[model samples]
Target: MPCAAARACPSFLDKSIHPHVLRHSCAMSLLQAGIDTTVIALWLGHAGVRSTDAYVHADMTIKEKALALNTPVTAQPGHYQPTDKALAFLDRL
Candidate 1:
């Protein structure tokens, strides 16, 4: 009952892979390729996109990329201009 792929591939010979592993692979591939989680959820038959969050949180590269785009808070504090236009409107009140 073993699939040919499992036989020919030495890496898969000793280990057991669940059907969900394929689902996980497909989801992770889509995620790394910049596909949205909504699409991945639909592919996996997940009722909610929130279920795909596990993959998002599981991938550390995504976290690393997010950290790379962040500006460190180590810079000396300086006066910052308030960007909230609502403040200006409130001030005029």
Candidate 2:
């Protein structure tokens, strides 16, 4: 059914999807499944993790959701309000 739709409307395939599009889709799917962005960038042959940001730029909402899911849980929630100890540690560096 999907192939038929693709055939009917080339635009549906986004003007003939290239192998890179398939690669991008695979990368995005892996990312959606909780895979690390750095790993995805490596798998997709990106020069750097920053290159992978392009795929994410198209969808900020999804990016936010991914970040929310992946963020580490702390004892307290809200934002990371650094403690005095943390401030001192940062000051040292």
Residues 18-89 of candidate 2 have per-residue lDDT tens digits of 788899899778877768789998887888999888767766668668678877786444555789999999
Backbone clash pairs in model 2 (N, Cα, C under 3 Å; residues 3+ apart or in different chains), count: 0
Instruction: Identify the candidate with maximal TM-score.
Output: 1
Clashes of each: 0, 0
What are the clashing pairs of model 1? none
| Model 1 lDDT per residue over 1-93, tens place | 667987788678788889979889989999988888899899888999999999999998887677666747785444456767978888999
Task: Give the per-residue Cα lDDT of candidate 1 at 15.
Answer: 84
Compared with the true structure, the alpha-carbon lDDT of candidate 2 equals: 0.78
